[model samples]
Target chain A: MESFFTDSPLDHETLRRSVEDDAAGAVLVFDGTVRNHSEGHTGIVALEYEVKLPMADKLVARILEEVRTEIPVLKIAVGHRMGRVSLREPTVIIAVSAAHRDEAYRASRKIIDRIKHEAPIWKREIFADGTSEWSLGCTACK
Target chain B: MPKLVRVEIRYYAQLREDLRLSNEEIELELPATEEDILNRLAQLHPKQAALFLASRAAVEDEYLPRGTVVQDLRAVDVIPPVSGG
Candidate 1:
């Protein structure tokens, strides 16, 4: 099934190719990766990602559409990896093309921030000590 | 006679792990708000009450505004604040 969420590795090349446009002068790619440690944690082994199915896909599409409205992006593509993502592996990838460098850069940044903040996706940080805890991406939920 | 609405509640992340549940179908009386679903879940699993109460509610594909009366609801996703990037 074609979806923003994938259990396998995200195909960055394919996504980049999707946003290739003749009129666009710049194509920017950004990937948010899993690191060894998160806030207040160390020796992180991996991150387990879970998404609200069907709905998660809708949220992703909606976010991208909204970006198009807010930014003058010529073309854009995004993918988020599900299941367990290892350290240094990208959790999400975003590619955008625009007529100039500034629009491409801005759209790329906003897409990453908004998707992380609004998408109905969650992650658990697994420590090397064999412990795991949910990453509290936002505190305003309380 | 009150018509009971059968709503499927789907859990994610910590709530799923805490309750050991992925989804459950439950019946509720009419005139129920989306918030009531969370309250009912808390009543069923008191141990995770706080998390359930704090979660955002989404029915079907869209987010149901807090305290909005659930109309034609079929499934609800109790989602924690997102962390994905």
Candidate 2:
């Protein structure tokens, strides 16, 4: 089964524990963390992220469609969190279960890369110096 | 007298912050080029002037070359190089 979650905090333990089967030999998980610094405006404060909800949902659905059709995986689960998050907090998680290690590894890597490139969400970095900027990825500090 | 057409503008990321706006509906005189809109926007939002000068404009979600005809001027998205991974 393939799962996608956008609202809840990504549960790493649950994902790893749940994605199991006697027929499957491997399960891979990828976790994305938010780092501090991006786009030349760094004073070390906080970040606020927003997304066009409808658009983001549709985009994720499309990515999952591609993953299922293009990747050889028995099951996949992906999640992304929206709303205020602090530095080093987990923002995205992907889990893949397959008959072999290679399939799980490949699918998990592709899912995160595709999401970062295609997702409609944006993050606003607020500096302690009262300056702020926006970036697509964490540590975009340039 | 000159004809006027409605052009929609949508902003994202840094451009949105520069313009201090998300979107807008503007009516500009016909035969108006993107440069004309850029100049006008510069006047309306001086803070975005430099950003607009450095950035490119899109008409109907596609980049319009400099000196291109204004045509109907619908669904213009003023974009920056905010496309990043």
Candidate 3:
């Protein structure tokens, strides 16, 4: 899929191959993982993501379309895991392919940034201390 | 009972936690706008007025302008500042 939100673990091979083509010379993938720490929260256990489907799904598609038009990338695919995502596991993955490394790299970065800023998805960090807090909220979308 | 329009309100993130509610259905006077719905919610939840007032309302697929009329709307999402990557 070009963009989506899934409750299950993301499939990497399929995401990569979704943009695989002979016309492309470079394909870059970005895997955003749930880490052990976030700012003041340490020993994080997992990250819980909440998204309103159909709306979120639609917004993601709009983002991809906007990115595609702005960048020279030939193809783009994005996947984000919803609900509880354990540490070290990929929470989001973005793959972009272009005729050159520069375009691919630029598109990959731009897409993720906009997704983070625009998509109506929420993340709460679960700490080892038995407390959780939503990260500094998205100012742009709010 | 007075004329009314019921709008389902779905809360998210900080606002949901603060309100201790996932969603609720609210009844407003017949001529209600997205802005009026929010004001009523804030009045009903004075303690969390800031969050309620600051929330953005979305109907079926898109976020509605605060001043847009809400009579034809069936559901509205009260979105707080998001934290997604």
Candidate 4:
């Protein structure tokens, strides 16, 4: 298992390789990238990700452990990017390996979903208009 | 004399933007609670009061109950709703 929060751009290939195993027949990967539009806003410039580093690191580890226990996966690796991510740039990646395709796919799905909702990372959308807004991930803040 | 305690407050996302502050240090009355600290922050930044009231507080990396005494708090992170993918 591996988890990281870095200001550097994410490398999906590196994450996939980290979870590669000889016994595993399937290696599934999920990449969350910055898109060009959100809601009704178009011509998006980039996404800014800010995190409470210590809490985020701890939560990512917890999520990885929980997912591993629930799924019979051989290996798992997850990485999230901090700082600014331009359009089409990846913000997060989750890779998992298992003896079969089903386990790998399911584990990868669960990891990403949990990380999005449970982690203390936040994202802001920067539009081409030079305006930005925080994405609503938690109800209390909205 | 009543002692004063120092608490560090860290902001994130929209709260940070609204207050134009990433963090701040405040001296509070001794034996203050998390709510007291938040209320104090709201007073200092009235424009962000609603956000403060809606946010959650974590002290020393642990989620703090509203009524928990904060005399020993070294820092508090005010977390807005998280939106990550």
Candidate 5:
């Protein structure tokens, strides 16, 4: 799938091969994982992701389209995991295939950045201290 | 005719917890803006007024611009700032 949201664990190898094509010479992948700390806070236990459903799905497709229009890439795929994700587990994966490494890299970065900024998904960081906080979207923290 | 309408309101994240709801149906009059809805919600849930007013709203599938009329709104989602990866 070029874009999707799931509750199951993300498989990096599967995502990389999703964009595999004979016409492409290079494939780039970006994996986002749950970290153990954030903003100087420690003991972070897990992350809970929630998506707005059809809207988030539509947004992902729109982002991919926008990126493809701007870059000459052979294929691209992006996926995000919802529900509870454990520490150090991959929460998102983006893969892009192009004739060259530079375009693949650029497309990979753009897809993830746009998904983070445009997708209507929310994440709550659950701490080991039994507290949780919602991450501020890209715009608000700035 | 009295300009009356009903719009579904969806809450997310902190706003959901603060309001203790995930979604609700609200009755409002015509010419009501998103701000009006937030204000009314704040009136009903005073403890979460600040959070309510701080949220952004979307009508149908598009973000409702400030001062946009809510006359034809079938649903409006009260979205707190999104945090996704």
Candidate 6:
């Protein structure tokens, strides 16, 4: 039951261990990273993401509810970052703990997909030329 | 004169900064449809109108089908397609 907005880099080891608690039989973690090329652009420097906290939280809650009903998730953790993130850096992390491996895997995948499609967050790409452009595939804001 | 119906307007992402507005409380004449509001918005702010024309919309958090009526006003979130890394 963890949901937070963070600017710090992701701690993968901490997340993996945290999800492997006493009651959990299996834990699955998925990481999303910033890419170098997007929307036919080159010379990409970094990306900055932002979200409307209240609305984003609501959307996340809905996704969590779905995960609870559809999967055997005992605990779930989701963290996303804002501000500047360098290439190859993690932007989103989700951990799912369940009694079985399948549920954990499915829940993590579902949650990540839903977050990408529904969250109100936006990312801006900074180019080496000191200009920026918005990333594509953002169906939520549209 | 027809009764005035209040519809709340909101913009997010680049469109918000482009419009120079976040949200506004206003009353539109009753029987006003979504297009009516869109037309008025275009008249009020052409740049935002272009943005809206290029984007999609959601009413009360749910994406509405094309040409839905705006009788109740409620809450409208004008969303533009945003990208993530």
By the lDDT metric, which is better: model 4 or model 5?
A: 5
* DockQ measured for candidate 2: 0.19
Worst 10 residues of 2 chain A by lDDT: A133-142
- lDDT preference between candidates 1 and 5, better one: 5
- Model 6's alpha-carbon lDDT is 0.74
lDDT scores in order: 0.82, 0.68, 0.82, 0.83, 0.84, 0.74
Q: What tens-digit string does per-residue lDDT give for candidate 1 at B6-66?
A: 8788888888888889999988775667677778888989999888877888776688876
- Using DockQ as the measure, the top candidate is 1
DockQ-derived CAPRI band for the predicted complex in model 4: medium
Error of 6 at A5 (Å): 1.3
Per-residue lDDT tens digits of candidate 2, residues B1-85?
4688777778767778766789998877767777877777667778778767655566644456788867666776665543222
DockQ of 5: 0.66
Clashing residue pairs in candidate 2 are A38-A140, A38-A141, A39-A140, A39-A141, A39-A142, A40-A142
Better of 4 and 6 by DockQ: 4
TM-score of each: 0.87, 0.67, 0.85, 0.81, 0.87, 0.78
Model 2 regions more than 4 Å off: A1-8, A38-46, A128-131, A136-142, B1-5, B27-85
Choose the strongest candidate by lDDT.
5
* Higher-ranked by TM-score: 1 or 4: 1
Alpha-carbon deviation at B45 in model 5, angstroms: 4.0
lDDT of 3 by residue, A1-142 (tens): 7888888998778889999989999988889898897655578899999887888889889988887888888889999999999988999999998999999988888877777776788898888877888876556334
Native contact recovery (fnat) for each candidate is: 1.00, 0.11, 0.74, 0.91, 0.74, 0.43
**Better model by lDDT, 2 or 6?**
6
Candidate 2 at A128: error in angstroms?
4.6
